[model samples]
Each structure stands twice: as structure tokens, then as C-alpha cells.
Target: MERILMSLQYNGAAYQGFQIQHDLKTVQRELERITQRMHQQFVRIHPASRTDKGVHALEQFIHFDSHLTLPEDKWMHAFNSALPNDIVVTRVNKVDDQFHCRYDTIGKMYRYRVYTNPLRDPLKVNLMTHMPYDLNITDMQKAARLFEGTHDFTSFCSAKTEIDRKVRTIYLSKVIETTYGFDFVIVGDGFLYNMVRIIVNFLTDIAQGFREVDDVHKVIEARDRTKAHKTAPSEGLYLERTFYSEDELKHCVAELNTL
Candidate 1:
């Protein structure tokens, strides 16, 4: 038997989410179904992140152990041919049997897109959140900065989150201007449920003058989920990248700042 690692990208609009749901379509279900057909046996795929419905991924990783012997390139080709058009395997490699995608990840980067044009762009409807009016981006940028560093993000996560430890370390946080609107880029050691989307809503509230930039400090201190803004729509969130090493994460932060 050999363990294989795969890097992939998917548009989450078509599926319920990344995890397998026997009754509904999902990224994992689609991948595993095709894999099982190829191997003539059950193959369980473990993913690095379980992205929510309508939350896209530019880069995601998964691993599985299969007894069928095939070259990495051929494995990718076979899967891509059988998988749905929305999901594409970007790369594949042999990995140690012990390497699990979820457990091996050291950091992850998430980006949320906001569109400011009054006229909705049909192309961007699935990619971003459209707001009719302009926003105070300068204030939004300030609010984004406040999310950096270590903090107990109790107020910024979903109330449904079962995780006990809300404390997490944010290494990088910034609002980058885009042609359509702006993107909230955040890199962190780990995240609780709906963390990124909630933060985006908080920043959006600040940009709209509904809240002050200093309110972020207040919200963080409150440690109450009700103190945060409503969770932004999942359509605008993307899992940008996942890192396995400290150096790779540091390099990505430096590279993102330059761009």
C-alpha cells in the first residue's frame, strides 16, 4: 500500500461542502467515489480543511492510502477525468503513510472578497459579496489590523462552534484593495467555525461607519459572540493556502505583503 497526497482547487457553489455526505454531493464524496471505483475498494480521503458550503478553495490538500499502484501523474489524470468539473486536482505526490493532511497543517490563509459596485457583476456573484455603495476602506484597513496577533476570538466565531479553545494566533491580517472591491487576507495558526466570515462582517460594519475602529478592541475584550457582527455569506470566503512548515508560512506572509 502507498499513501498519496493531492493538492486541489474547487468551486464550492456546486456542492454542500468538502466533507462527505452519503446522501448529498460533496468534494470528498465525489473524489472518494471515483477513487473507490479505480481501486475496486473503499478509499477514505482525509482533507486538510472542511470548508463550508459556498466557501471556495484556491488550494486544499488531501491524503489517502491505496493499495493500487499507479504513478502520481496518472493518478491525478484518472481522478480529474472522473471527478466533477468544479473540482480539479492540481498536483499529486507519494507521501509517508503517517502523513495526514489535517494533522500536518501548521497554518492556513483565508481571503474574503467584497464587491462595491452598485451594478452586480454576474461573473462575481458566486465569487464575492456585492454592496451597492462605496465603503470607507481606510477604516476597514484599520479594523483588519486589529485582528492580528494572539487573541481569544470568542466574539468572532460562531456560537455553534464546539471547540473549547477560542484562543488563536493571527500572524498576518490585512485588507488588500482589488479592482472590484477589497479582499480581507488573514493568516492564522487555527480558526474556529465561521471565524473568517464573522471578522469580515465586523470589518464591513466598520467600513460602513456602523461601528468605530476602536470597537474591535472592545469586541475582543468582551469575549461574547453576540458582540460581533453577523456572519458574512460563505460565498465570499476562500481557503487560499495551507502551510506545513513555519518557513513556508513566513514566506507566504512576506509574499502576500509584497503583492
Candidate 2:
């Protein structure tokens, strides 16, 4: 058997999430079904991240062990032919048996999009979050800087999370103004449930003058979930990219760096 790794992109608006569930549609369920049809056997795929419902992914990674002898160049064409319109396999490669998608990740980058408008745009309804009020971009930028470096993000994660250790390192955090609105790009070593959403909401609160800039430090110091803003809508969150060491993903890093 040989282990193969593939990069995928999907529109999450129509699916439950990345993971499979009984009687529900999901990215994993669709991929697995198509893979089984092609290989004529049960193939279990392990994804790099288990994104929440309504969250999209630009370059999600997955790996599986298979005995099929399909050539590397034809894997993308074969998988894309069987996948639904919403999901596509962008790249594929054979790897050593020791490579594992989830465990081998070094970091990930996520982008949250928000637009300021009086009425929601039908075209962007499932693509971005709408903010009716004007935002203070300067204050929001200040708040984003505070999230950099290592810190315990207990206050910025979903209360439903059962993980005891909430510490994570933020490698990059910045907000960029776009034509219609702004994009919040964050790179982190790892994340907890709803962590990125909560952070975005907190930054929005600060931008709208609902929360003071110093409140970010106060909330982190307090480590209380109740003190944080409500979680942002999942539709605006996108898993931009996942990072691996130079040895693991040498060619992919250059492409991702330009994003």
C-alpha cells in the first residue's frame, strides 16, 4: 500500500462541515463516497482540519493509504471527475508512509471577511458577514496587534470546548481594508473551537466602539469567556492555508506565501 496526500478546495455553504455525520451532507462524506466508487473499497481519508459548518477552505489537505496503482499526474483528474461541483482536488502526490496530515501540520492561516452595508448583498450573502454600522479601522487594527504572540485564549474560544489547555501561539495578526470592507488574516500554531470567530467578533466590537481597545488585554488576563464578544458568523471564516515543515511541503509553501 502507498500513502497519498492531496490538496482540496470546497465551498462549505451547502455542507454540514468537513467531518462526516449520519444523515447529513459533509465534505468528507462526499469525498469518501466518490473515492469508494473509484477504488471499489472502503477508503478512510484523514483531513488536516475539521472546519465548522459554513466555513470554507482554500487549500485543505488530506491523506489516505491505498493499494490502487493510479499514476500521480492522473489523480487530480480522476478525483475531480467524480467529485461534486462544490469540491475539487487541486493537487496530489505520493508520500512516505510516515506522513500524517493532521499531526504533521505546523500552523494554519484563516481569513475573516466583513462588509459594511445598509442592506445585505445577495451575491455575497454566503461569502461575507455584513456590518450595518461604521467601523473604526484604526482601533480594530490596534486590537488585532494585541493578539500576536503566545497567550492563553480561553476567553476567545467557545465555552463548549472541553480542552483543558487553551494556550496557543499567534504568528501573524493583521487587518487589511478591501474595496467593499476588510479582511482579518490570522496565522497561528493551532486553534481551539470557535477561537478565530470569537476573536473576530471581539475585534468588531472594538471597531464599533462597543468595546475599548484595552479590553482585549483585560479579557485575556481574566481568561473569562463571558467577557468576550459573541462569536462571529461562520460563513465569513475561511481556512486560507495549512503549513508544514520545509521538508514536508517544499513546493506548496511558495504558492501559499503569496496569498
Candidate 3:
């Protein structure tokens, strides 16, 4: 058997999410169906992260063990040919059998976009959030800084989360003004359920003058769900990248070297 790693990019607007669901169309379900058709066998695929409904991905990572003896590079071509227009297998490679996508991912990066114009742009409706009012980008940047470093992000997480630890490191968080609106990029070790969306909502509130900038620190410290703003809509969220440091990748290879 050989383990394969794949990098996928997909528009999430037409699917339920990444995970497989019987009644819904999903990235994973579609990929798995194509894999099974190509190999004529059952396959289980594990993903780096299960993005929520309406959340897109530019470079989602996943892995699976296959007994088929096909060449490594051909997996990309084969999968792409079988996938629909909305989903594409951008890259593929052979990896160690023990390399699980979720466990091996060192960090992930996400971007949330907002359209800050009085007149809504029909073209951007699928890609960005339309905010009719002007947003203060400078204030949003200041608010973004408060989320930097390690902190218990309980307040920013979804109430449905069951994880014991809410603390996660934010390597980078920035709000930059774009031609359309604002772009919020956040890179972190991991995120809690709805964490990014909630953070965006809070920052949006700050930019719109609905909330004070000092409230950012207060919400981080509060660690209470009620203290945070509502979760931002999923349409603006995109999984930008999943990363593994050179050292981490080396370590992973070393551990599987003898296999």
C-alpha cells in the first residue's frame, strides 16, 4: 500500500462542506467518489480541516492510503478528470503511510474578505461580504493586533465546540484595505469552531464604530461566548493555506524513513 497526499482547491458555494454527507454534495464525498471510480475500490480520505458550509479553500490538503499501484503524479490528472468543475486536484505526491493530513499540518492560514461599498457589487456576492457602510481599516488593523500571540480564544469560538483547550497561537493577523473592501488574513496553529468568523465580526463591529477598540482586549480576556460578536457569514471565509515548516516536514519524513 502507498499513502498519497493531495492539494485541492474548490469553491464551497455549491457544497455542504468538506466532510462527506449522504444527502449533501461535499468536497470529500465528490473526491472519494472519483477515487473509488478510478481504482474500483473503497477509499477513505482524511482532510487537514473540515471547512464549514459556504467556506471555500484555495489549498486544502488531504491524505489517504491506497493499494493501487499507479504512478504518483498521475493521481492528480486522474482525479481532476473525474472531479466536477467546482473542485480540482491541484497537486499530488506520495507520502509516508503514517502521514495524516490533519495531524501533520503545522498550521493553517485563512482570509476573510468584506466588500465595503455603498453599492453592492453583484460579482462579489459569492466571494465577499457586502457592507454598505464605510469601514475603518486603521481601527480594524489595531483590533487585529490584539488577537496576536497565544490566548484562550474561548470567546471567539462557537458555543458548539467540545474541545478542552481554547488556547491557540496566532502567528499573524492583519486587516488590509482592498479595492473592494477589507481583507483579513489570520495564520495560526489551529482554530476553534467558528473562531475566525467570530473574530471578524468583532473587528467589523469595531470598524463600524459599533464597538470600542478596547473591547477587543476585553473580549479576549473574558473567555466567555457571550462577550464576542456573532459569527461572521461563511461566504467571506476561505482556507488560504495549510503549512508545514521545513523542520516539521523533515521530522515527518525522518520518522517514516525506515518504513
Candidate 4:
């Protein structure tokens, strides 16, 4: 069997989530179905990240073992031919058996798009979260910087999450203003369920004068879920990139800034 890693991009509006569920559409389910059809046998895929419903991905990673002997260059086109229009395989690479998509990931970068316009744009309804109220972008940007270090993000994750540890290190966090909205980028060693969404909500609340600028520090120290703001909508969130090393992450940031 040959092990392969593939990068994918998908619009998450229609699917339940990335994982498989009975009688529901999902990215992994569709991928496996197509792969099984091609291989004429059951196939399993390992995804690097499990994105929530309505959460899109600019670049997602996965690895799978397959007996099919197709050339690496043809895998992307072959997979895209059978996959749904919303999901597409961008790149494929053959790797040693020891390589794992999830375990080998060193960090991940997520971006949240917020529309700050007074009127909602119909074109962007599925992709961007509409926030029609006035906001202090400066304060929000400042608050984002406060999250740029290691902290126990217990207050910023969903209470339903069963994970024992809530500690994660933030490598980078910044909010940049765009023509119609703001883009919040966060790079972290790891994340808890709904962590990014909750952090965005907290920053927005601070910008809207509903919370103090220093509340981020207080909530991190409190480790109380109730101390944080509500989780933001999933549609605005996108898995921008994943990094396998610190150097790769720095290179990605440099490349992204030029775009």
C-alpha cells in the first residue's frame, strides 16, 4: 500500500461536517465513497482537522493508505473528477508510511471574516458574518494581541467539549481591516472546540463596548466558560493553513502577506 497526503479546499455550507455521520453528507464520507469506488474496496481517510458545520476551509490536509498505483500527479484530477463541486483536492503527494496528517501538524492558522458594513451584502451571506453595528476596530485589534501567548483557554472553548486539557499556545493573533470588514487571523499550536469562535466573539464584544479591553486576561485567568462571550457564527471562519514546522509557518505568513 502507498501512503499519500492531499490538500483540499471546500465550501462547508451544505455538509454536516468533515466527519462521517449516518444518513448525512460529510467531506470525509464523500471522499471515502469516491475513493472506494476508484479502488473497488473500502477506503478510510484521516483528516488533519475536523471543521464544524458551515465552516469553510481554504486549505485542509488529509492522508490515506491506498493500494491503487495511480501516479501522484494524477491523483488530484482523479479525485476532483468524482468529488462534489464544493470539495476539491488541490494537491497530492506520496509519502512514507510513517507520515500522519494530524499528528505531524505543528500548528494551524484560522481566519475569521467579519462584515462591518451597515448593510448586508447578499453575495457574501454564505461566506462572511454580517455585523451591522458600529465597532471600535482599534480596540478589537488591541484585544487580539493579548491572545498572543500561551494560556489556558478554558473560557474560550465550548462547554460540551470533553477534553481534559484546555491549555494552548498562541503563536500569532491579529485583526486586519479590509474594505468592507475585518479579517482576524490566529495561528496556534492547538485549539479546543469552538475556541476561535469564542475568541472572536469576545473581541467583537470588546469592540462594541459590551466588554472591557482587559477582559481577555481576566477570562483566561478565570478559566470559566461563562466569563467569555458567546461563540461566533461558523460561516465566517476558515481554516487558512496548517504548518508542520516553525519555519514553514513563517514562510506561509510571508507568502500570504504578498497576496
Taking all chains together, each candidate's TM-score versus the true structure is: 0.97, 0.93, 0.93, 0.96
Off by over 4 Å in 3: 246-259
Candidate closest to the true structure, highest lDDT: 1
User: Model 2, range 46-126, lDDT digits (tens) per residue?
Assistant: 999999999999989999988888898788898898888989898899999999999999888899999888888999988
Tell me the tens digit of each residue's lDDT in model 1 across 109-221: 99998888879899987888887776899999888989999999999999899989999999989999999889899999999999999999888889889999999999999
Instruction: Give the local distance difference test score of model 3.
Output: 0.86
Q: Which run of 10 residues does model 3 get worst, by summed lDDT?
A: 250-259
Query: Which of candidates 3 and 4 reaches a greater TM-score?
Result: 4
What tens digits encode model 4's per-residue C-alpha lDDT throughout 1-259?
A: 9998999999999988899989799999989998898889988999999999999998899999988899987898889898989998989999999999999999999999999778889999779999999899999989998998899999999999998998999878888899988999998898899999999999999999999989889999999998884899999999999888789898766664554
After superposing candidate 2, which stretches have Cα over 4 Å from the reference?
246-259
lDDT of 3 by residue, 139-196 (tens): 9989887898999999999989999899999877888777888888887889999999
Residue ranges of candidate 1 with Cα displaced over 4 Å: none
How far does residue 215 in candidate 1 sit from its true spot (Å)?
1.0
lDDT, residue 255, model 4? 60
**Quick one: RMSD of model 4?**
1.6
Give lDDT per model, in order: 0.91, 0.88, 0.86, 0.91
